[model samples]
Target: MPREVKKRGRRQEHKERKAKTTDHHQRSTKRLKTDHTADNGNALEVSGDAGDDFIGFDIAQPEGAHELQEETQFHGLLEPQEQEYYANVNNKIVANDFESAEDRATFIEAVHRETEGKELKVASSQSCSRYLEKIIMLSTPEQLRRLFSKFLGNLSYLVQHRFGSHCCEMLFLQAAKHVEKEHNKNASTNDDLASMENLFLQAAEELEPNMGFLLTERFASHIVRVLFLILSGESLDDDIVKAMLASKKKEKLDAPASKESELPENRRAVPKSFRTSLDRLIRSGVSTLDTTYLRALATHPTGNPVLQLLIQLELSASGKIKLSDENSVFHKLLPDPELEEDSESAKFIAGLIYDPTGSHLVETLVKQMPGKQFKKLYKNVLKSRLRSMSKNDTASYVAIRILERLGKDDLAEAKELIVPGLPILVSRRRTGLIKVLIERCAIRGVDLQDVADVIRSEYTKDDIDFLSALLDFKRNGVQDKTQKKGSESEKSAKSAHKTDVHGSLLAQAILQTSDICNLVQDSLLAVDVSTLTAMCQDSASSRVVQTALSPTEFNIQFRRHFVPRFYDQIATLAQDLTGSYVSDALWSATDGLHFMKQRLARDLANNESQLRDSPFGRNVWKNWAMDIYSRRPGEWQALAKGQERDQPQGGPQQNAPTGEKQKSAIELARERHAQKKSHSTNRKRNPATGANAAISTNA
Candidate 1:
């Protein structure tokens, strides 16, 4: 009984101990759980709390023990808030929820709140552009174009103000290309293109003034190209095409009325206001527009209709803008105030007329100005313009028309104008203008002498042929006028005197003209011998002749006179007889002697003429004639043989008989064979060699 009681007591005591330990452990667990929740909630609010103390007893940490514990607990607790914040922030930033300025501002404000001062970054322009691209991809073609137009509209202002005029121009160009591409893809999308066109037109209206500088000289051509594309229905709107056509038709219809009304002072004044406005615009920096653009406006059918109007206005204004007085009010208003011979604006104006498309403009200019003023202005502009042109390209078709117009009304002024401008044509070798000028001068009954004088003064000697022709026409005019004034009997005498005067003037002119030798040759070949011989004897001809013909003309004159007579005699002799060598030889000998006498007389005459002109006439004449005589063995031998046979020892040789004797019987026979051998040798040489030898030998 005692042993059982002891064992039971031990068991009871063990149970009691176990129950106490369990109760204490349960209390500690309850306290730790409550403490851990409180600590976690407050840890984030505490500075450097670490939250490690709140970690469960079962947890273990590595190197960043406190940090890892704090992060894990903090993240676990704040995961919902973080996710909610990020979601709201991303939605506000990326979503197109903002349609208006207010919405966009509000959304941006929210992003800033979410980011809490940590750099609030927004999408870049490129990003926005890419977003737009994606929208474009998903959108219909029309929708895409509309969006593009809207984007362009918004960007253009920014592009112009923020970037520059060039940027704005580029943007518009890009927009145009984009619209063009879309239009190309779907022809039916022209409506969309038309809408864009309207937008561009509106934009152009507002931006054109500011962007004027962007239209460089080359831009004119680009604009024209664009207009052409539009006009041809290649890439432009129908409205623009219709407008251009209507404008052109209106211009054509108005042209005749304008021309007719141009005669009246009040009617002519109508274009002044328009001209003033255009001049103002051009002077206000629009002149910087690329030459290409100007050319396009002038040439391209679809180019800006307004540009055409402006061109007309400019041309009209050019007519009104005159240099009348030293302090001319209207002239002062002109863009180029300096009346320089070579003004830039003048060149530009000339170029405007030079273009084939500017033909109408030139006609309009002529019509608008007073007849006299028009001639003067046209000449000035043309002269200035031609001077600016390339040597090879100076003779524009427009110049010809201007000259024709001038010739019709004011031939004298036209001649004066052509004098300066003629060199330009000459440099270009434009024979067409030359012929046209000559005809016009003739038709207008302009004094050929005056025209010739002007041409001679202005152009080089190489153009003397042209000048001489003009002079000939003038001389003929004088003769015609004189003949008209006199009776038939007196007409010849009067005409002869007039001819003499004209010939004298022409000779003087020819002598004074450059390259007199060449001029004489060309003139002699082209003009009548009567005219040439008269010119040769004229006092004015002395300048060129004296310089060119000191010794050579003496020989040349003799040759000139002798050769023709010799050929005439040879023809006569050849015609008279056929077979009979002895008779032919005797006849040839007689003819040869006659030729020698005639040549000697000519030489003597030429020497005499030279002597009369010079102080040492007699001696010079003797020396020259003797030199020529010595060169002819046939004549010299004949003279020696005839002298020996006629005078047994001594007798004075008479001039005529001596000349005949020089080429007498025997020497003439030898000369014929020698001449034949020389002819054979000449025939054996190449034609080119012979020609070269001839020129060289003559020189």
Candidate 2:
């Protein structure tokens, strides 16, 4: 389409659409007015009841809520001055990332005045809720304490209020240090200590009665976490403990009956929206838990993270706490036949081995626990179960790290643990884990036929090549930042020259198992040529193509064999926008890194005629020609003589097509000199011939 004609069509269409939209709006307004006139009498009849109730509820104001009937719209109606005040407070709270003391005070004073039972609910608009979370994070201790006073006086009332419940959660999280320090203060007398520890015990005791109400509360469930933190470790106060028990029951009851009915004993439960928040609550305050409470959380999706944190705490802090007592969570990991494989105690240890949330705990024991504890945990697992768990995504990540950690300590046991699981890891394409087992188990002299079988069956040749490229850079320590392949790693290099970051990073952290690099190189060399060629053309796998084709120490022999056999493809790769990267790597290998430079130089020198005719080949030739002419002038003269012998026009075309633009100033000057010499020779010959003819005529 002509540019101006196309633009005019678009402009005409836009005007027609705008006219239609305006007409639609006018029609809608007229319809609304017609409907309102018809309902005016009914609205007048209901206006009497609207003074105290709007839409059947009090204090139910929405940001811009309104009605055709005004009778029921007055529930949250405020004086003009009051509306202006809250609006200004909301703006100030939302404006500053780090609010000043003055802004905080203004927010607190405004909330304090209207902090009565249901008054704060009016401020729970979508915009208000969004900014309120930010203010909760920035609140000062003094402001929080005063704010807490407004709601804590009536805890149940606060629980029922929409926005008040959220405000209370912030007060509790920020007041944690204040309470903890108060509990440890230097008090000469009990009275001084109790006063310092006032809020901790007072809040806990006052809120204890309504624990179930708070736990099941849509916005108030987090309050239960705060009360639990105030009770320091090992001090299992029965009432507060009972409150926690009640909260768990509340979590169960809060679950919808339909979902509860849908799940069977063996099936996973439907996830709750609030589950992660409650899990984080448990994780943050897990230090205050006893073994009994820790056990309660072991099998829970969210609660399991709490037990994991407790295990980490126990291992890292031996002086401060005891964890192997009869009442302790880990006490069960010590083998006993009566504990049985399917028993709660055995299942608890098994959960850590395979559960996504629980695997890190298993990894901790493998990597950092005492030797005796490591043996106890490993022996407890059934080999079949270990195989089953290795196939899981999250579990496999930690499982590999565990294998390596154990391999370093006792190679024999690590092999036994890894060999059985290799098939599952390979079938699942858990390449990361398969690599660790390959490296760590190889040194232990364990046979890897089963693991190798899995890799062969599952991964394609390109995948194998990618793995080899990662292996090369990993061994070489030359990394590119574009490791990951998705949106999260968008900061990756855009240049075709750069390598993948995750592939490089994953390979970089590989154990110093040099034999594994050789094994991967052999596998790559053995990959089908057709498969390798297609892989080289792919953007995702091209980095691997570059590294594999380069003359690295690990792949030097293979590169020599591969490059000459497919010289045509190698030359084609030189000029391709994407494939050009591989050619660049070859140049770097021959000149820069000097990896078998003589072999590469000899190969190129023999292909001189081939390089002259191809575009990308000529690019490679120019680079080598510059180097030879600068430092090896004698060799340069011989190379020039050989290349210029059969030039198309009996002169060097310099790789340019036939055109006026193809001739340089030097070539043009040579042409002019040749023309002048020809003219002078012709003039001399003609004059001599004419003089001879005249002499003959006179005779």
Candidate 3:
């Protein structure tokens, strides 16, 4: 080797910080810079008391001052054969082409047997760690508890390890649901295994000593956030925490996530012990780190997110009971409850509004802080800056969060400030703010005509282009090929190609409001048949078409005009994945138009082969019940009208053909009620004839 360069050790780095502090005292105006590169092992170490002097300003640190040695725990390595075997198992799970659920269960059980004593070993291996994650994701409660017991004493060390951190995070998330499940049933496994809730408590206790250190540790901070969510029984699917977790770039596994991972909840049922532990854990981090260190973490790359989550937990805990707690982290960040202007806390809040990392923390505070503090902060710091903030790249999101909590009067003021900049927002692709303003206006009974006018003015092209612009649809001539592609342009192109999820959402919100719903309905109705078909085929814009056809959003006249445009393309729509959804929407759209319904059925029948051959096509055919229409058109029409008989004149006692489904209870009740009403009407019509009829019958 030409030369071997060794990395600096922890002691050497600390000494360098002490030296910098002395030099900074000699020169007060010189600024130091901090490294923001993506490394998870570094602890947040501030250079001098210089940051403490400037209360609300950004405190930069030198490059080497914040480095913490990444400690790798040496779990025993695997043999060649073991590595190959585990890799194969990983591929099998990733493929997930099982015949049935039972088969997958059997395969998992076999995997458990092979990796029984080597859980930690597999977890620490870079190549094998993902296999462990898949195993935990698919593990039963009993198996999860077994792994939890195996990693009992080693958690603090494992959390700092690069690969082991992922395993620990997965284990905690997957095991959290079991605690609630056992608590709800008031039972545990009928074996020697400890209760999952108790196991969770013990795991927290194991990491208690290292709480403060882990909060700033690169890999450990992520695990700490997950642990806090588990203790609080907060949903892991929250958008705030989801954004924080995605800060680190890692390859997402293709394995199926659990139900708890998919379904979101406001909160889950954690144990009383978990609550106590949560309180202690929160206190441990606050008490261990002094005010200076905690404040420094406000802008620290890895620490900022964890700090945001902690502050939210503190504010939201026990119905905001902890809001005034003296030792609370939120209290430490802003000691003044009033947040007076020119105060250090106020300056801090102002600085965070525009920072890339600190703004996220500001958002969490805006959402969870007490109402009095929010009112004071908004009046003193944010009220005059609404227009400027909404136009900023990073601060615009913070502005959106503030809008979510504003009162009707405040929202109207915000609307006035933001409406003037609609053109600027559109130019910067900050349509999210526009969408939120529209929603709040509708909710607060503010005038929506202003927003409608802005939209109409900006997209002054024809109706097709208006709808296309709202949906962010790109046409061939919209942009010249010679235009330089920046980062923003690339992002827009990618989003547009994938159907622009946010654009679709904006269109749906606009259609929900009656004041401006016609803007979209009129545009959709005015499009040519080919463009209409293209919108129906798209994954995102197709939803807008369905909403427009819905009776809640549009009247029958609109649907009558909209439904015919698809009649010629019914076969094409039925065969497409996205277009199939539009085809289903047509079924409900033609609710009372019997002629349109008949025409639709005739078109579907003509394309029966094409519909039956494709997968999405098959789903459309089944949903429309085309088989019944082909065999018995009369019964199909009767059933469509909520009747069970083949003919409308048949009594309730008359059943359909054999092997047909039975009538629902509501249908039977309706028929019985109609029969009674008809009998009484006949008797009322001819009383003398009814008496003569009865006398003849008795004779």
Tens-digit lDDT string for candidate 1 (1-699): 455444457888999999999887666544333564576642222313222322121122122212211211210122456546545544444555557756654554444344332210111122222222222222333443443354343332333221122223333333443444443453445453444444444543333343333222222323322322322222233443334323343211111111211222121111122223323333333333334334444444333343443433333434444445322222322235442447754555565564654544444444444566555565566654543332224335555555666654565655565666665654444545555556566666665565454455544355545435433334554344334543665445434532223333444434333333244444445545434333333333323223333224223442344234332222222221121111122222223345544453344444444434543333333322334344664544454334333321111222234445444435645777898999998886555566788897788
Clashes, model 1: 17
- Reference-based lDDT, residue 306, model 2: 36
| TM-score for predicted model 1 compared with the true structure | 0.24
User: lDDT of candidate 2 vs native?
Assistant: 0.47
Per-model TM-score on C-alpha atoms: 0.24, 0.42, 0.77
lDDT of 2 by residue, 127-167 (tens): 34434444445544454455455444455555445554555
Q: Please tell me which model should have the higher TM-score, number 1 or number 2.
A: 2
Instruction: Evaluate model 2: give its TM-score.
Output: 0.42
Off by over 4 Å in 3: 1-73, 95-117, 184-187, 246-248, 254-266, 461-464, 472-501, 639-699
Which digits, one per residue and each the tens of the lDDT, describe model 3 over residues 1-699? 587875679998888889998787666544433363234443343434423322221223222223233353476999999999989998888888889877887888889889998988898899999888998888888888888999898887788888999999888888886787799888887568878988889988877755766777767888998899899888877775787764747667667654654434567888888989988777766675556678788888878988888888777775356667778788788887778788888888889889998998999889997888889989988888889999999899999998998999999898888888888876565679888888888888888898888887777545446777777766542232113234457545534454566777778888888789888888887777876776777778889988887666347777778788888688788888888888887776776776786788789899989888989888777667678788878877875554554322321222245676655557766887999999888775544468788897787
Rank candidates by lDDT, best first: 3, 2, 1
**Prediction RMSDs, each to the true structure:** 37.8, 24.5, 10.4
